[model samples]
Target: MSHVTARVSEGERDRAVELVQQAYADGLLAPAELERRLERALTAVSAHELEPVVADLPDQVVHIASTGGRVTRTGDWHVPRRLRIDSEYGRVRLDLSRAHVPYSRIDIELRLAYGGGTIILPAGASANADGMRTEWGKVICKAPGRQSPGRLHVQVTGELPYGRLTIRRK
Candidate 1:
């Protein structure tokens, strides 16, 4: 989805600062990166847009995993494994393990929806198909130089459906 922009509130800004500070203290981000994200948060237009940018900060990080049975559901839900991270300049990984569907080709889908950012895959890592199947939905793992720090889009598709997506620091 496209990013939604608007004016940010005091509470939102405060939360942003708190998150950034925590990231810095944890040594997840460098001094410069912390300053950059702080500036963005201070002058953010809207909470919605700020959230993604802040979430993608250099120190802020994330890790998500999904397997068989119900993973993400509404109300009275229980996550066998769930982790949401935020750092200054870090890595976000998604480990997906899907069971095979016998003779039929299982369709494994991966989606990365954010306002704008870069999607870095594992080093020397290459997708089963092209770097990224644009028309098909999966995000193209653009070169680091071409990485957009805003509104990154990713989607992974698999037929065998037995693999995991992991995110970690170098």
Candidate 2:
């Protein structure tokens, strides 16, 4: 339980590389350090190696659960392959229109109660909320449902009792 030795996927490697490059571009890393970290990130075999490469960088958000608070993500944020959200109240807004989406397909699992959620996808990104279930709420997907070649597909699943989930394309 102390270490994770699982083999890294190309997606993971690419994400790390992007983070490193971003750090350099943001002037958080010097040229020599950027080159060093980029090389290590590209050759990383597991999450262990990736830890050091991005240890000083901004942490990515993949999971969020709140009892009662508003949740929002906009601008140039990084989108992981999968996202999990649990909220008891307040609104959850996620705008991926200008974010860094490195995956072709993204999965989102939501658990909300007595609140609403909105997700805005980038242009040409297709998404579907078919897998979701609601007891006293509604799910509206304004984007296309089917997966398209060379386009991003988002699959959303979960339960949002007494809340609404709105997914639309920008």
RMSD of each: 17.4, 6.3
Residue 86 in model 2: lDDT: 90
Using lDDT, give the best candidate's number. 2
lDDT of 1: 0.40
Writing each residue's lDDT as its tens digit, candidate 2 over 1-170 gives: 59558888885786688677777877899999999998998888888877788888864548998889998899999888679899998888989999998767777888888888999988988998988989999999999998788888888988888998899988
Q: What TM-score goes with each of the models? A: 0.31, 0.64
lDDT against the true structure, each candidate: 0.40, 0.85
Top of the candidates by TM-score = 2
Clashes of each: 26, 0
Error of 1 at 115 (Å): 40
Candidate 1, after superposition: displacement of residue 99 in Å? 45
- Global lDDT for candidate 2? 0.85
Off by over 4 Å in 2: 1-61
Model 1 C-alpha lDDT per residue in residues 74-133, reported as the tens digit of each score: 223222211232222222333222211121111123332221122233332232323222
Worst 10 residues of 1 by lDDT: 99-108
Candidate 2 clash pair list: none
